[model samples]
Target: MLAHIHIRNFAIIDEVELELEGGLTVLTGETGAGKSILVDALGLALGDRADAAAVRHGQKRAEIALTVDVGALPAVRDWLAEQMIDEGDECLIRRVIGAEGRSRAFINGQPVPLASLRTLGEQLVDIHGQHAHQSLLRGDEQRRLLDHHGGLEALATDTAQAWQQWQADRRTLEEALGSREERDARLELLRYQVEELEALALAEGELETLETEHRRLAHAEKLAAGVQAALAALYEEEFAAQPVVARQLRQLETLAELDPALASVRDLLKDAEIQLGEAADGLRRYADDADIDPQRVQWADRRLGRIRELARKHRVEEQALHAVLPELTAELEALEALDAKLEHLEQAVERSEQAWRALAEQLSQGRQQAAKSLGGEVTALMQALGMAGGRFEVAINALAPGKARASGLDGVEFLVSANPGQPPRALSRVASGGELSRIALAIQVIAADAGSTPCMVFDEVDAGIGGGVAEIVGRKLRELGERCQVLCVTHVPQVASQGHRHLHVSKSGGRQTRTKIQRLDDTGRVEELARMLGGVEITARTRAHAEEMLGQAAQSAALRRT
Candidate 1:
């Protein structure tokens, strides 16, 4: 239940606080007295779009806050928890619009996105605007209204989910089938590419090894000449340096026998001869091992050129050329299995489509059953709301199976005839705005009786209705209040008198006028009603008449319980 509402700096409303109660509460005032401003203000708290013009002339911003008693509302509590807001028995929703058109929303004093506030607001209240009947003309809304009334929302949801699943599966199947030719062409290309990659078959590190070998073989001639020169100097040449040094050593040995100074050099000459012998052996071995094979060098160069050519053909770096082989092999495998994969996807699509149709069939039957009962209830309600001999029907027609729609297989419409002998037609075409408003009221009352929303607000639902019908409308509204708290904005004294509580909206102060809303006591209600009864003047007769109407309204309310 909406427990309270506070408005500050809103258009023509400087500050107004309302302590709301559960019952039929009516707001009555003269024309242009801001009777509907309360409704507009409540809309803001419920996350309605705000504008700078909504703020008062000199105020920085306009603020609207609503306090709802949510002790019995677990959805609201859960939502608060999900939004990370402060939790309690009551939830406060506030919205503020700056003078620059910027806006903000808060729940339990925690700022939140406008969307979060909107989602929670939808659960808390259902406001039936004066033009609600216009929506009744729409088949989609008609179907939704019927579903809600019949408690088939779960079935509707199941149908929708099934349809979406079928759509997704169908998309996959279409893609697989649509690209069959392309896949075949790709299969041929991948096979050829894979075979080429496999034929190259380059081993890891082979390229580096081949390059190193190629460099050494290409320079083998130069390497061999250097080794031969060293060997000749050490041992090969008859006039070689090592031979000459050996001859000198022999001469020194003879001299050393003659001279003692020369004898000391003999040990050094022997050491030099030993070192030269080792050097000559090492050089001779290297010269023998050197590879100057031009044929082998040509083979290495050809192999490296083939690898580079393959790398270029595949658009891969030489080092990464080996990595491409596996990817091509995988693609070839998938192409080989393409036919089987497509067959499997086709079966899945068929299964999902069948599932959606099965659920749609159930929903269609449920709607057919619900339509009958709802139509009867609404038709009965119309008679009580001043449409005597009226007929209301819920028309359900099947659409082609190939036609895809989220709302199941049947198209639902609300048809109405306002008088006897009149053929039933679409509600929008058959009913005036006044008739539409009353029909909307009847539907809401029926929905409320079936245990839907706990709070309903009707702004000027009594438009174009008066006389005994106005009394009936008031009585029905009061009765609806018994099931769900109802807030009505009206100028009808009959409706105003029937409310358990009443509010009077009027301009206060001079020059700079501001809207003032005050909850009326018994005397105040009577006075307000009298003012509604007699314009500009509250005569004694009007007061007496207002009191009489209130008495009769109370009596009528009692009889309804009986």
Candidate 2:
């Protein structure tokens, strides 16, 4: 149940704080007093779409906050826990809408997506707008209400899922069968491509190896010549540097006996001579081992040419050629098994259709049973609301199985007859605005007990009918409050008189007007009710009548409790 709400800079409200209770609370005010604005603010907190105009003129933003007591709702508690924002049994929801048309939502002070707030809000509050009857003319809405009334939402969801699965499988089968020629052509191409790539048998790093070997073989003669020339310069020729360094070392060693400084030069000459000998030996081995083979060079060049050709044919780099084979092979395998796959998909479509039919049939049966019960109840309520001998019916028409939709194979329409001895016809054609309002109220009152939401808000649901009908509507709402909190915005004096709590909304100020809501005490309630009943002027007689109404309503409430 909603325990508290704080609103700031919203519409005509500059700032307001309201401490709420769990019962039927009524808000009464003159037209344009912003009675519905409070309901709109609560709707915004519950994740309704926000508008920049909702922010008070010249204000930067509008803010709405609500504190909900979830002690009795284990599902809500579990949802809070799952979101990792649980704080005992109370949940705080806040909404801020900037003047620039941007909005943000928070749960327990932690920023959350608007969708998260909506999900949690559905579990906490069920708001019935004044215009609900207008939408009730829709077939889909009728079906949804029926399912909700019958507690068949889960079964309907299962049926929808099965229908979706059947459609998906059927689409796949149709696509495959329709594109058989294209599939066959693609299959042939993939098979050939896979074969060619497999035959090449390229390995990782093999491209770099082949290129290296090709360069080496192609330049074998030039490399050999360079080695021979270096060998001659270092040691191979007569009177080469090796023998010269040896003679220099012998003279330096002899002088070193006389002067120790010459010993350093002698050691340098000896090291130079040793390096020259090692160079000559290395050059001799290379001349012996050099492969200057024309046959191998030709073979390396042909292998490289073939790799480049295949790379260009496949529209890939030579280095990437190794990846092409596996991809083509996988596609080829899939196409090769097309017949088997089509058979499997056909069976899947058949099975899915069967599952969908079973669930839809079960749902149809439930709706039929629920329809009978609901029609009878709403018809009875219509009579109580002053539509004597009125008739209400739920007409279910079956749809073709081959063209089944996600909702089901049934189309539901609400039929109504608003006068005695009149044949029931489509509600949209037969009911007036006032009659629709009464009918909508009837459905809501009946379905209220079927829902588990802790709070229900009605925005002038009693908009049309009046007199005794208004009093009955008020009593029904008060009865509903026994199970959960209900907040109603109404102008009906009878309805306002029946609430467990009454709030009077009035506008003050001129250009910068602000809406103020005050909870009415006994005398205040009498005055407000007198104003509603007597309109522009409140006389002593009107005041007396308002007091008597309150007295009788209180007595009736006490009797019901007993």
Top lDDT prediction, candidate number: 2
Q: What is the C-alpha RMSD of each candidate to the true structure, in Å?
A: 5.5, 9.5
lDDT of candidate 1 over 222-313, digit per residue (tens): 87888888887777788887888799999998888899887768878888888988888888788778767779989998888988998998
- Candidate 1 versus the native: TM-score? 0.77
Task: Indicate the worst ten consecutive residues by lDDT in candidate 2.
Answer: 444-453
For model 2, what is the alpha-carbon lDDT of residue 125? 90
Candidate lDDT (C-alpha), each: 0.85, 0.90
Off by over 4 Å in 2: 165-178, 188-331, 338-355
**Residue 367, model 1, lDDT:** 86
**Cα-lDDT of candidate 1:** 0.85
Looking at model 2, residue 273 earns an lDDT score of: 85
What local lDDT does model 1 show for residue 394?
89
Evaluated at residue 325, the lDDT of candidate 1 is 84
